[model samples]
Target chain A: MRFGNKDLARYPFLREALSYVTKNEFKIEDLDNSEFYHLVEKAKRKIEDYVFEGKLAYQIDYNKTHEIIVQEEVIIFLISLLLIKSISIDSVTKKFALFESMRFERYLISDLDNSNQDDKTVKLILYKIFEDLFQTKVDLEVDIFNFYKIKISDYLDHPIAFQEREWNLVNRTVDKGYVYLDGSEIVRLFRNELYLLIIDRIKKMNPEVLPDMIISISDSLKSRWEKMYPPLRAPGHQDILPPCIQHIYNQIDKGENLSHPARVLLGTFLIYTNKSMEEMIDLFKRLPDYNEQITRYQLEHLAGKRGNTKQYFVPSCEKIKLNNLCFETVVCKGISNPTQLIYRKSSK
Target chain B: MTSPTTSSHTSSSSDKLKDSITDSFNYPHSVEDDPNKIWLEKVFRKHYFNSSSEIELDNYVSEHEFGFRLFDGYIRRHLNFKNKRELIASIIKFSPSDIFCSPARYQHPSASMDQKGWIGADLIFDIDGKDLQLDCARIHNMTFCKNCKLIEKEVHTSCSKCNSSMVQIVELPCQNCIRNLKKEVTKLVEVLHDDFGIENNSINIFFSGNNGFHIHVVDESFFNLSSMKRSSLTQYLLGRGYLVDNLGFRIDKSDNITMLPNKIYYNKGWRARLLSRLHLQLKNHRIDDKFMRKITQIKETNKIGISGVINNQIQNISVKIDPNVTIDIHRIFRLAGTINSKSGLVKSRVNNLTTFDPFKESCIREDALVKLDAFVDTKLFFNGTSYKIKTGINNIPEFVAVYIISKGIGDIYIEKLK
Candidate 1:
């Protein structure tokens, strides 16, 4: 399954697209030059749209032949990555990754849904991605539920945040090491991989490499980002956290090893108090054994950010006692749940 | 023969070893021991010296964390040996009550658990006879309540007098229960082989030196399975957590579940297993034509439907392995060829399940005559040989004496003779 120049523009994250860009010798100097002025504007617009709307901003126009910029898309994506890296803010980088992967997810699904058995290229690309790229074995007979059989190892490594019993490996019909999933679900899995791939290129860059066009675009992005996005940690509510939760929070703050149940208590407590994804990631990164991969999987699962989409509630005082996690204080006497502790403390 | 003085003082002495590196203590002297434990130690010492070849240590032996439980109930852990001879030497030196080794390979085998860089571990499923809940256990097992001090067959959940469930069950599981445990192991092997695609040769089963068995999947593919994946494997074998919705069943708009009976494929996964179970139920005439008609005809009623039959099938599910043992990757399993403290029998490897008798084959010590004070009326039945030994002084085989003494059902008769 070979990709054409138009397909390359659509999936610049693919190895073939990167090779095409490298083979054409797309240079960094072209971003600041008149010869690639078409791409420079598009790259800046990509970063600007990412910081503000968290959306990808490019589309192909096959009908309008004069406006076709198929050859410049990969170069624009690379320059956009350079601009993001020059910005060097972690939150902005994460936002860029999330948007790009989501956009890819949207595009990939539309492409697959539009294609049929006669479209030999889609079937070939399915094998090319599963067999060649991810090395995942696949049998693509879309069943009654639009599900296809995939290998268990590949299924286990799926990057999508799913906590539903339906998503559980045991709950699915696993036959001879194969799990079932739909095309959209499969795209969701690789979309996360594409996210991490983009993130790797976005971390820790020399703002020294910023061109005039990139610098102007980044300045606008930074100002807009500072105005729009809230700080990862919201002020207040820390003191009002239940004693049991506070104990765990303090333990993590000091880079101590809290037990699994204790971490769950603290995680659910923070998530329950309207702490966003970035805030939770910020809070958990302070732990001694914090592995970003593991923490993200668990935190997203608890937040119900993915499958089943059922958010976890903080354990009540009675339930907390069953796990032996309760540290009752005189101020917490009447409160039955941890979420109530905020009002309990503020009332005093 | 051990001196009468040493045998008498076995349970009296305190631990005298101060050093941690050596981890050795005088067997008949300062380290307090049980008489049954001392006898078992003597048997193990001879067995390791003679039958060390049979005790196969897991590969990369230097990277395995070995541990030993002493007669005084002290566990010496985080020990490593370079070769098989060194392990045997330690076994012969310590005369430990039981032997154990980690299934995991570590960078620093002697380091603390967190410090031990765990590379991988074999997937093991432990099937203890007590967990099987076989009816035969009531005939041979005994339960002693902590509060009321009542001793009887293991048929009570709560003490009649104290009403407290603070009871300890002493299980000398008979041949019947052991046979049931073997059947469970067979089921587990089949499930691992067929459903999970684990080869039969890659799966090794060991009698747990007691009334149980341990299955180890030694294949390289499974060595690096995470705790989550291992947990799923356990669930699959036990027939729990299956999604009937994925297999052509759905809750109807009117509330009752609607299932496509025509779509039930009798060739793959849970559908195949469930249909086979239904076939058995049909053969027994328990599931009549009316019930079959009711199942295929159910659409939109408030009445409870096919869920009852499915729930019944799930209840009488497949494998009966202890889930905790499989899920925990860091667990130290009993090393094969080591004597189990529960019954003074070796954890021997089994070849033929039909003829393998734990009481007979796992008995490594010479069958010498020994007198014992039997504590209860217990039956020792295997291979058409049955002994319904009653309370008070009785003569029995040395192997039988060690078992009965270790199980807390009998005592060595030397003290009574004196």
Candidate 2:
């Protein structure tokens, strides 16, 4: 958890760091400058302030919102790292120059604002702040938040990255053309097909064994899926869906030879996509020791179309009419790959 | 089809997985006696009762390597036991109720060499002998007498070392490992009770016999769950706030399998479980569709397929995991908007020709980065079942815009200039 500017002000150095990030103008060159002096003084004062206050922010009013924002500080830390990556000596000097212009104290602090804050006095103060307030950069680098992070490479292969990037380029915006499908259309197109598929799989079964059989099939699908896309090739990048897939992938990876039925269940959902409940049932039926009736009940119940209260069931057919679906073009036509499908179509 | 018994016998034969003989044999006396005596008795009893004669088997003690070969002893013992039928019967009557006959070790061709191979110790007792070692000794033949005890390859040479012997064994860990594991288990139990909803009736926690604890949600509600629901539950268990990850588990060898109430993301730690749950809710229903519409997205990018003529914005879009797979609809539309706008020009210019002007761009791409709003839509499903089929569109949240703006997409400037 972390606190924002409102909370950081209770500690002087953190407050200074926050202020410097927001207000200071850094030059690409020259460490000794007036603004640099102020930066040093401010940072030093914050540190001294923290030392005296003894890190006492506990008594201060803390609400749920503040707590959440504080917890998300790692995200801010990443941004800071990115900023630091681009900072050169010249940029440091420029920032110091901006600081000196603000009539800051000189030389009691070590000037991290860079050599541009070469006013010997400002450098002293800045140095003091770095020494006292912040932990060593080396230590920070190894911190769990920074070092133990899962690199994108651990989850994605080159081909998947290339493909995802290409798709990203292909679908650039919401204006060119795409479509959305309504509930009724989806019902007409997928309802019956899904229903029949589910029924067919469970039509003939030793009633007692049917449920377990269906569950097992689900697990097989999931396990097969994880095998297909291991965590090293996690499907999506920082994407919502991708992370979800990654979670499932990790589970299968850990418990590959699991004997439990639950393990099988996990494997099924992770990999089984683009198929309706009925289709999944049909897929399950092809395996050994499967019952048909239980699958019928489960699939029907799963899609919320089993009991007949004008249920918007899955459509039974494959061919989709152009008029029944909705689309909105996100990218301009003729700009990139013409054959790529980059639109999201929603059906009930 | 053959009867089940025949099939079972075939199953056993196919795998060649023997029901090891160590289970049946018992030492003549307590294991504390001369360790050598205990070892001999255990091996002798297995072969004598294997329905094989004991007279053909032989037994002897040797100082050169401190070992015994079961195969030679098997034939002598088998013949001897068969000849002394009355004595064998009397011994059996006196034996403990648990004792039974076991298979004899078969002799192999090169039993004279001390080379490490399957010595097949029919029964194994205590292994605490001074310089004691048990191995799969290669059996050569029943003809070798006690003085000419079969010697395999000498112990630990460049050519061979004693390989694994098929025998019953027990193992215990070091003190340090036990202490550390106990502490971890205690901490984990507390975490489970506090967070996982694993109270008395619905759940049970168990040791995975290695590292980590397993919480079994025995709630009948979860029994016989389909793949989808189970996945959802798994996600919820591992998600953040559940702290499924922090349930410390020691990674070392142990017998008690620790049951993890929920799956951990990394070695141990929680990611955002609630977010995943929210995502599920969204995916199940189209409720987040409105939120998705609020965030500006590109138009359909499906140029190859037939598409609807409506000019509506993107919502409830699905992205495929396969990167090579073409964008279905929303991705395409988002691309089109980007390609045709000023943001596109900025993006292209940054990557290609002259330095791009961020000032003029006004962070247009940033607008697209806003976290897309999302919600689960119950109205979309015809049936009212709500266990979890979370489906919905996610709008880029507002906070994400700054970062997205900083990171420009490809070909943005070119489209803008055009």
Candidate 1, B1-418: lDDT as tens digits: 0000111112352322221446544434224445656666666676677777778676688998787777766556677899888989888877777777888889998877778899999999888787777777776678778887766776677787788899778877776887888889888887777667688888888888877898888987778877777777777777666666644555553445554443323245565566566552222313345544555554223145556566676656568877877877876778877777777788888888888888777876656677788877877753245767789888877677777877777777766355
Could you tell me which 10 consecutive residues in candidate 2 chain A have the lowest summed lDDT? A171-180
Which digits, one per residue and each the tens of the lDDT, describe model 2 over residues A27-112?
Answer: 32222334334333333332222222222122223444643333223223222122222221222222222222111222111122
DockQ class, candidate 1: acceptable
Native-referenced Cα lDDT, model 1? 0.68
For every model in order, the fraction of real contacts preserved is 0.43, 0.00
Top of the candidates by lDDT: 1
* A210-316: candidate 1 lDDT, tens digit per residue: 56777777777777766654343333576676788876755554334456767777778777777777877766654534567888888888888865687888878
lDDT of candidate model 2 versus the reference = 0.25
- How does model 1 score on DockQ? 0.30
